[model samples]
Target: MHRLAIALLLIGGAGTAQAAGIRCDGGLVDRGDLQIEVLDACGEPDFRDDWAAGSLPAGVVAPDVTQWTYNFGRGNLLYILRFRNGRVIGIDNDGYGFDADNTSEDCGPTDIVPGMTKYRLLSACGSPAQRDSRVVLRSSRHFRYGVAEQIRRETWIYNFGSRRLLRKVILENGRVVRIDTDNRGFD
Candidate 1:
């Protein structure tokens, strides 16, 4: 009987951890929360991406699985939360966005961080040795059942020379979000 009781306690503990959904700004983004609710609770994330996990037969509506990225700046790990049907389904860090690269630049005794404008980056880096810009569509049905807000987003990449060690910088909507070594080399 004692053994059975111990096993129950272990199972309950595991479930409790899983039940605790995404944590943000001193609050929890629990399951069953609508898209708008998550936004209200967590505010605007550093990045947002929407993708289709699976589709149903023709003439049938498919569920939308969206991923929202929140980067707590330089020294913090990036968090990705997955949502479906306007509710957050899971959260994982399968990808280590904070590349193991140890590159660093003083940039005038200061470091460039998220929220810095593009012009600020250009002035500090004196223009990227290589630059890339692109636009992406951000659409998902995970929005409120009766609401639709499809939009497009822009992202720009700056490579201040591949061998510089302090390689690439990612900017979205005119703000810096990430900076790391150029694992793919300058192209």
Candidate 2:
């Protein structure tokens, strides 16, 4: 493989935090701080926006990015943090943030449940807070090492803040198979 591909593989394989803290409060919130640290520093964002497919600028990687919106009472500039491959790559001041908070205490029901079709799930929850997909090759239970089985796994995250925690929906073969939750509530 080429150098870029190799680097992408290595970076993606590490499975690091997709989003992190915003620079605010006259203090510094640097890139690669992780989601928890971001939450601790920024408190809670007013609203969030996620994009799975879009026109990326030249030389930028596609997919696997989480964008956060923080509105500190409107007078302050809205912070938009973009995390790529598990770390914050850039931070910008978006025009304004929603008056309504995006926290679990504020966000409506996730509308995600087991056995729901991808379409229904998307329609209900919108494009996930963050998305990650991977392919693994392993031998089946038969122990035929030469005959490897391919497994495709996709994980979608919805951050509902501390009240509802974060929801992790796991899918296999384009179908929901399991659901998990954690306190890492920032999507």
Q: Per-prediction TM-score, please?
A: 0.38, 0.38
Of candidate 1, the 10-residue stretch with the lowest lDDT total is: 1-10
Model 1 TM-score on a 0 to 1 scale: 0.38
Model 1 alpha-carbon miss at residue 133, Å: 18
User: Candidates' lDDT values, in order?
Assistant: 0.49, 0.52
Query: Pairs clashing in candidate 2?
Result: 17-86, 104-160
RMSD of 2: 16.1
lDDT of 1: 0.49
Q: How many pairs of residues in model 2 come into backbone collision? A: 2
Poorest lDDT segment (10 consecutive residues) of candidate 2 = 1-10
What's every prediction's RMSD, in angstroms? 13.3, 16.1
Q: Model 1, 40-67: lDDT tens per residue?
A: 7667755566555233334445455576
- Give lDDT tens digits, candidate 2, residues 31-90: 666666666666555444444534333543445556665555434444556666656676
On the 0 to 100 scale, the lDDT of residue 125 in model 1 is: 48
